[model samples]
Target: MNLLHSALRLASAESPPPNLNGVVSTPDGIVLLGLRGKPLPAAFDMTQDGDWILPSSATTAPTARNSYPAVASIGRLEDGSTVFTDLEADSVLHLVGNRYRAAELLRNIALELGTSVWAEDLELIVVGLDPDLTPLGHHKVETFDDLRPALQRFTDGLDLSVSELDTGQDGAPARRAAGDPSDALVVTVLVVHGVDLYDERLLKDVCERLLARGRTSAVVLTSSTATSLPGPRLSVDEDGILADVEWAGGHVRAEQMPQDLAVSLLDVLATAQAPDEPVPPAAEEHPWAQQMTIDGAWDPELDEPEPAAEPLPSPARTTEQERRLVRVENDDPDLDDDLAEWGDTETPARPLIAVLGEPQVRAPGGPPPIRAAWQIEVVVYLAFHERGVSREKLTTDLWPDNKATSASNVRRTVAELRPWIGKHPTRPDIEFIPSLSTSGDGRYRITGHLLDWELFRRLRKRAQARAAAGHIADARADYLNALRLVRGPILSPLRNRGYAWLNNPDQHHDTLIPGFVIDTAHELVDLSLAEDDIEKARWAAEVGRLVDPDSTHDSPFLDLMRISHAEGDTGAMRQYAELLLAERDFEVGEDLPPESFEVFNRLFPNGLGRAVDDR
Candidate 1:
């Protein structure tokens, strides 16, 4: 059932399966029908005379053959290969068996076809069978109480032109020629129960017409009584064994579905068919721009400079002679020189702890001799809360369920981690993690050390400042440095396992770190594009994509699309457009945003529909 759900989810986003004589092919071009017998089938020799290659031998049991037209497993061969049959094969398939067994086979086929990715364009017209398929919620399924109305409905839906239709040898109208069309052709499979009750002439006419139209197929549930329907007869016994399968050679046990499983499969397909909630419009603009700024307010002046104001005399200048002397003497060191000297001596060594990609502890010595996983988690937690966290808060967050020993657990963890973190580099007397009692306020926090996360933030802040000051090159440099520190998503090494506190909406590193990354990447992209450095722009966009591949914030994709457009790579532009469109379709069940559509339309004036048609 999980496999069925996965297949449905994947199939819903993709185009219909390529039509290979009514056989549904997976994305990998193989048809996975289901399991067969209890042992592996011997591999077929390549030197054999046959054009088709057989599956390789395996010592394992229940082998599934990936050959064509074999859409579902009916039974197992003596050699362990599955007996597959395409329920929607090109010709009409008449299932002759015990009434209940035949109906069960029909239900199984319906369920498989309904959930199959390859059958996206398949329309099932079920007549006279009440397997309770309404709960399936698939748009293609239509159940009728009688055969006459089902055939009438199927006939009325046909939209063939005069040139498209031709009289077959049996005088039934069929498709004249199979031409490659702009859209995928629909394959209608007419499933009928109790064929003897229907008018024989009506059944024969519909089957002939269906066979003439090469893309269509039919399956009829018939009693043991001879029926006028023309096709190979597959007999199912009361014991559920299928006999006289020409392709399968001998009889094999037929697959039947329990009513409960059919219902469950239908429910899952219904859920898969349900439309996804619309993605909110928040991602249309740069969501991170406001958050990445120094004052938490993005400045428009940073992007567009205002008019120069009237010049005013500097108050620091004494007179023209003093100003000239000051300029000539060059005795006073500028702010850049002073900051350079200070940076050379004051900038701390590489952060001892990193929470950017993996939660890592690079102690003064090679690797920290930390004993437990909790010790690393406690350090990362404290590092994230740079201001400091109280003993009560830390315990409650880290061990919410284990309250009685939470306080002691924190105490023990910090005590064990203290030695490994070593003494503060600048202040040797002060340990990296200060004892709770050492501080007047009983809050524990890391001191005299920086985390990679903190370093990234500092660099981003510097980049923001540089950009605001119109130092484009310097700002670009700072942004690149910040982005380099981001090896992956925040705390990716810990994943979702130990970071309970991270889920707190009030202090969410998940959103905060990615926001900074996206905003910085966008800044670099804009700077690079302004300088016509397409390679750098591409690098920045790719990095932004790495952080949020799902396009939770779609500005990164939009930036990439814009870059692709600039490069005049229409194919790449369309690829990005389709990705953005697919994301929107999955998340919001809607079209691309207007600006995004504009970019796509600019490249392909006829629209995405025409672009697809051209393909």
Candidate 2:
């Protein structure tokens, strides 16, 4: 069941299944490490000739793979027998050899043990290693800067486990029978890159104490200099091969994890353990429903006649009004010249499909003929994939479960969509040219119509280019212009209904579009704040929130908190802080992201004080 659960999680994270190729049957308590060279006499009783003898146990099923948490593979003999180590039974395993080789071998052991199916209750405390293992994101895997504190914590935990066992409620044997082996004395493995960092006496004392208990706890030490300690010592050569062991006649390749593969595996593990999908906000709670426009304009409905005396504008209101006026008046021709090279040739006579917000085909002639949801989807898909999608790929993605009818369905949908997309201005024969070739296997692509998303991307690119060239003011304008093109979230109309392909992590529209929106808004907010334009800053933050209502990125909420603090609005500051905290709750074991917590602490040194105090 554990193996099955891990496989399912890997699938969800879009990662390859675990490689179980070398896995073979092993004894119950012996634990299968990598293979060792078998004696010629031992090979006589084996199924195959050269690499046969594996420590077999009657209790273990013939087909069962290595029981992880209890087993670890160190290296393989030249004849292909895997060398096994019983981590649960072994109290201390000292790795001595070239510092770099030993460290690499230790890292591989940690990776294998950490990513095992039964590693949920396994705690790995690593010291003096700079490997970027954080991407694994497992709550149990931790890195410590100093050995003293980590050792102290380990001893404390050991004492607690020992005390729990003494209670006699349920001993380790009983817990193992119930299939919850970790209930008593969680499997904690301490991996130290350099054993010489601590006093040799203290290290030996700790290991001896752990060995005395005979629990599923152990310490793995790696060192460059030769040192004698209790338990087995495996010397690693500069080439990462095991030496001074009777297990082989030499030429054993150690199991080493490449940097890239480790990172990829860690990413897979992180994704598999990601927090539950956050619920979408209700329609009323959505940014669009809060009287806030995507471009940061507030369009409140008038409830009564205007007052005879004009009300004094708050700092936010004054800046917002001025910003609006600046946008309307085309007073600067130089800004136009900076963007002239990238500007569109001319506006389309027909309304282009709008996908930046709601998925819609705006045909100026009359109501669009595109009535089916699939028709709009087809057009939107082509608009995003300008390179064109093959018919098979499109059908496969769109109708994954109903492959038999998908080809016909896609053909009919495209046919219905092409007419509404309209013909190219100069080419009457190309009626939107939904397909590039007359051949049946030709690719499907939409042309002759512009996409709002494309325009948004163009403006954003220009803004970044301008900013890189040190044209701050022009860059700000470009960012604002790009933001104004966004009506709401990308494909807001298809929130829960369709477009399952967008959920893929590789899709640019799913990942990159939101990043672009958040970045643009964040930059705008910073620029506004730099100029002391409080209202503009507030507006920029709201625009960011409008696109990312879930507050996935911390910058938007952080911007708002700063804006509220600058305006001396404690009430608003507290609200933004709470929202920021909720959004950052995805972090495992941590209260908040570092930057968010820092801002929160700065705003409310006495903790998010009572809301009534602000009043």
Candidate 3:
């Protein structure tokens, strides 16, 4: 590997440590490195993550001051893992498996934390993984963590404590009490190490919970030898954008990454805890028990799940996690384009619905009658409307514990939908996007030719516009039609588990579509309030605030109070204002509409309402 080789070649330390992958020494001089492929190192310390920073001068410039090359020669290992080859064989040396492992250990131990996945496994196996986490290479790690006892002997009186594993009474609590300099937050972060995109379920849970609470999130891949990462770190911050996670790398030329970039990618391994579900400290630490179905514990919690028992060649457009987006784990730049293609589910495919257009298609009990199975068709239509959902979610909703084969059932359902597809004025309303290979890269596409939901949206917009123009009848009709899409709570075939978190909710969904649903509700509330429909307005406002508490200033309840003022119902206005003020969660802001502010002032002369208390 050019990068690692260069890093080592430049090392100018007096009698510098060898450029082996797993070598370590404390501030004092003691060496540890793995010999051959042995599980344990010949001599070393046992810090879960070892620290290895090259001599500062050696790190930036190679021993041999060679200029950049258009095509850098990098070494590739068979196990899909790679290391940089430095031209400065003198100043820098390639550091791959063992070195990487040593770094992993030192950094973590410095942070006073344990490696979640390899806590007990001092022997590490470093494999090259593509951005999508596909194994491109592998290599056994020979590191200092394997020689905890020997290193302790060497230090004698050094200020340190290293161990073989972290799970048992590792004495962290004792260390902390003794002023080891750590807090509960640091400990919590330590617990979530060894997790990442590979843990799809955990990722979903974390993102959803965060969104529900209106808390901003960042998914930056960081680097640090200490518990905390440093440098010109890029954070996603409060804005919901994909750029934060994308900065690490689309595809890593594992063999050629600069030492800094390599360290950055390591951060993606996800040792820092981003809650699977934000369990309040007051609640059980782990609300959900582990259901271990896989072996080999490198964070099995985040390990890629096995394909469904029956891996069926799904109909065009159906994919699992079609929206996870494709990522490249290699150094290949072309990977981004290929990934983009997988995500653009929009296409010309017609709805997966059955058609009523076929002549003689309508038959009696002797034939596959027209409406014998309209349920599947409706479900598929809803799926299409949702921009596509995952099979796990769909199955969970449809057959919670039923063992019936899912493929056969889905196929049978698709067959049933073929007859009535064209019934909707917009035939393109439904479609099944194709999936990309066994890797499960994909996206759901809504066809441009479809006018179903868009028509409803347009009607809703027009209704709002006309209502402002005092065209009540027309506006009401459009509003009713737009709400028709809600015929049954966003519609998921998933039956019993609960789907409220879905495009349609019942329980199938793990959580609600916090952002989207909240926005929709608020919009509807604004319309209802403008139309003087106080009851509908208040209901919409409450739902909106529940979805996102920050929307308090614009909640429908507040708007209705203002309408009451214009209608001159001072009593009703006070009653509605009091109701809004009683909402336990909403923190009303000073930015309330001027009209609403006036009405609120009238209702609560003291600028505070205490007629009732919220739970």
Q: Please give the CA lDDT of all the candidate structures.
A: 0.54, 0.56, 0.31
For all candidates, what are the clash counts?
1, 8, 81
Q: For each candidate, what TM-score against the reference?
A: 0.45, 0.46, 0.28
Predicted structure 1: clash tally = 1
Q: For candidate 3, write residues 81-166 as lDDT tens digits.
A: 22222111111111112334323322332221122211111112122221211111122121222223322322221112222113
Q: What is candidate 2's lDDT per residue for 1-615, written digit by digit as tens?
A: 111111110111011111122232222112232222322222122322222333221122233333334456677666555554556554567777876677677778888767654444567877776566776554767788877777877677667767777776754423443445454456677777777734455577777776676544444444444665665577888787876643434655666776566677678667866886732221222222233222222233212224326533323434433433222222222334423422434544444777667787654233444465666776677776656788787877677676547566777777766566676666666666445455244888765555666545445544554454456787688778777767887778683557877865545475456656777788788877877889878887877877776667777887898888777787888777776765654211113444565655455533443221341
How far residue 599's Cα lies from its native spot in candidate 2, in Å, is 4.1
Off by over 4 Å in 1: 1-351, 403-406, 586-590, 594-606, 609-615
Top-TM-score candidate index: 2
User: What's the lDDT for candidate 3?
Assistant: 0.31
On lDDT, the leading prediction is 2
Model 1: worst 10 consecutive residues (lDDT sum): 1-10
Residue-by-residue lDDT tens digits, candidate 1, 319-425:
54333323222322232332233234333342367676767665553444544466777777877676688888887778767653756767887787776777766
Root-mean-square deviation of every model = 14.9, 22.1, 27.2
Off by over 4 Å in 2: 1-351, 364-366, 403-409, 436-441, 468-470, 495-497, 583-590, 598-615
